[model samples]
Target: MRNVDIVQLSVFVLFLAAVTVVGFLAARWRRGQTLMHLDEWGLGGRGFGTFVTWFLLGGDLYTAYTFIAVPAAVFAGGAMGFWAVPYGAIAYPLVFLIGPRLWSVSHRHGYVTTADFVHGRFGSRALGLAVALTGILAMMPYIALQLVGVQAVLTVMGITGTGPAADLPLFLAFALLAAYTYTSGLRAPALISFVKDTLLYLVVIVAIVYIPARLGGWGNVFDSAEAALSKPDPATGRPSGSLVTNEMTHWAYGTLALGSSLALFIYPHTVTGALAAGRRDVVRRNAAMLPAYSVVLGLLALLGYMALADPGVVAAVREAGNPQLAVPFLFDAAFPAWFAGVAFAAIGVGALVPAAIMSIAASNLFTRNVYTAFLRPDATPEEETRVAQLVSLLVKAGALVFVFAFGRSLAINMQLLGGIWVVQTFPALALGVFTRWFHRWALLAGWAAGMVYGTWTAYLSSSPAQEHFASPLAEIPFLERNGYVALTAFVLNMLVVVALTVAFRAFGVPDGADETSPADYTADAADRLAAPEDPGRALTGEGPR
Candidate 1:
């Protein structure tokens, strides 16, 4: 067995225990009449203001995998990893535009998931089911990667054992996550996010400042990193990575940034965070404030270069044969045991916050769009909430199973795969908020085309370490340049949508009814109050208000 640092482990456990208590207590943080309604349970009563929404959205988007993987990407591939920084910068402006609209519509109509909006907007259950399934499917790998993030931190702490015992800690941690998430719903993550983001900010600030001063200076760190990155890998004769993008890589980098930005808020977890806001202005305000995280993300990405600067960290990561270990190993080598323990706790709690939100989001999709729409059209608010809580546990458990069954590569591949699938929903969800000119069938067809092309293209991609699902970039057909598969597929999706809509309109195909009003997209909290008392009737197009 590997020797564990007792001080590091102790600090980690103490923080984790504290957060567990906070999570359970969060059930009463903003107590409602009862947690038996989707409005209250899944969306925290839609009462979160700017401060809580900022932390919740921050905790939701800047995940633990992000904490580990972004730097690891830089550690493995140099400048390309910094694409996340620009991607993050670009995403929130889009959020500033899209978020208030989504919140407005969801709040007005009692929509819990993006699929709920799609269903009401298009008046097509089939299209709604398509969106729901895609969200759940895309989220599985994402949730699993959070577990992978926790496991990476644990592995660096020397918490290892044989067989099933190796994953006991992971299982226990997730069990704690599942319990609070089940009991407190979205409120659990929202409350704990205050702690999660605080620790993360503390860790990043200290690492960026203290680590550089310790390693000679920023100049020495960059010089060492440039030297290390320029060296050729033994597995391939080509240079491992470069500090700047070259002619051949510019297209890939730009397209990656664009695709990732477009896909960021489309993820169900992000939508969940946005809809939890008390007012549309809360979503808008949080969007403007959230860009502050991009600055931190850029600084965090520098840790990759910092790790490369430190021979001890590089050697430790090399010995482990996993690039994901780069940041953790850097912390272990650079900080004293006790501080390193704090950093580990930051990563662990970071995983829990996002993981909790992801499972809740997925459950909301299943319960709102799938279970209620198909299984039991007459399900009460209480039954829907119960089903969502149960499904949240199952989602987390499924992610745990996924981590052990698929091994480590799935974590590496998750961002691109999830982006590829989730971005396909943009037309029905994002664009639907603006216009409904696109035929429902056309949108569904476009989604199908994108899903197939993206999945197949991603499957054909290969890398030195793996045979399939190995890269996010592929050769664009007409452009004849390497770019993000998600963007290329998204282009194809749009084309199909346009062509099919024109063709269907030319043929006079019947377009589905739209239940939402133009005013719904611009409605505020006061407008929601003035609207119908029973918004569920609006969803089902039942009795008159």
Candidate 2:
């Protein structure tokens, strides 16, 4: 490892302190609001306008993981890594369809989490519990991946060390994160996202345009990457990378892109940002505008190929035994110390935005679905907000444990595993918004089957480099060819759901009560759904009376 660059470290520290201040002050951004309620604390007063919502959702969705891992994947897997570009491109269209409906129903019903929607929509606490558990489980590794991004920056900056002492800086950073998130809640991330996005946009644009010029232009960069990737790996006896998906990878790439697009908005963090909007139109507007990030993402993926063109970077990261550090190392080697620090800050701040949002999303799930629904049915809004605040800190602790235990070596695999677990909820949560024809029991059973199959198959997949959680791709059962494990499991899940729904109907098994009206699914911000109805004084994005 090289000696720490003081210039880069100083710029990074300055950015970190600035965002921390922003986070704490965010609680007062909209003054006179009592943040004692879940609506205020967990969803940022549900009053972010179009401009803020765009930044918030973009920061939340694109994430530090996208900034770090997509490039790392390209560095490691070649053309297959570019699946993120298409997946990101297709995601907003899917969000455009589902976002308004979810916002409408969630607004009309005062639902804070998807489990709250499921519980109220189907009147089945058991099914809501299932969804809640699935969300919390999936979010743990996803949050850990964000920490991995931060850790990569630190590692490249020469701040990371071994043992408990090595993690002190990370621990201190998250402590600050937990404190501001506890004080300001969703508003912390919302307010800080502006700064994060600014730094990230500047860094990514420079890396794409300026770096290629420094490295002998785009043509040379691509040629170098292709030459490197075409060489066969000594361990696996397969080509290291490719410019396009071949017979072996086509199925996995296509399925991963499609399935990830379907699952994107269904994750609790994604919905948390959507529902935080002040108006239904905000969600739709953001959906149309969010594709701009995908353009940046496509540009960002090329940095991986840029790294491959640098033999010094490839050798250093390979010596360090982590592929996820590729982008950070690339920036460190190619840029001056001061500019490199700015790039590191971009990634570090990028991780903070989504990490805060995800912790809130998971905590909201626990507070609404588990704590109140099971332990304290008479819990007040103030109590719910308090529990969520406490749980947010706990969620961060869990993510820290996961990162420390698993280490950075498996960051990408763990994220893929998280996706596999999360997508199983699609048949229950996402489909439930459009139709109530699915029996709650059938959906639950299908979720169970998919979770089991996905997990077991993922466990069985081992490569020459690793013994478990080797890759997201696996052979399709009975087809004897490789595909994304999550998508393959989801197909089995839907088939089981269909078969069980038919049998349950024939047996006259009761479908749970649905409290939502058809109009509720399409209600807009202008509708009377915003009027005071429930005694809890639900948020209408106008602040408390």
lDDT of 1 by residue, 361-407 (tens): 99999998889888888788889999999999888888877676554
Model 2, 1-545: lDDT tens digits are 56787899999999999999999999998733488888888888777899999998988887877789988889987999999889977778888988999998888767889888887677788889989988998888888888888878888888866678678766876787799999999989999999999998899888988888988998999999998899888777888779788988888888889878877898999899998898999999999989888889889889999999999998987898788989999999899999999999999899888999999999999998899888877777788889999999999898887776664664767678889988999987888889888888888889899999999998888877667777888988787778888898899899999999999999999888787789988887655343332312332123232
- How high is each candidate's TM-score? 0.97, 0.96
Residue 79 in model 2: lDDT: 96
Q: What are the runs in model 1 whose C-alpha is more than 4 Å off?
A: 405-412, 529-535, 543-545
Clashes of 2: 0
TM-score, model 1 to reference: 0.97
- Compared with the true structure, the alpha-carbon lDDT of candidate 2 equals 0.85
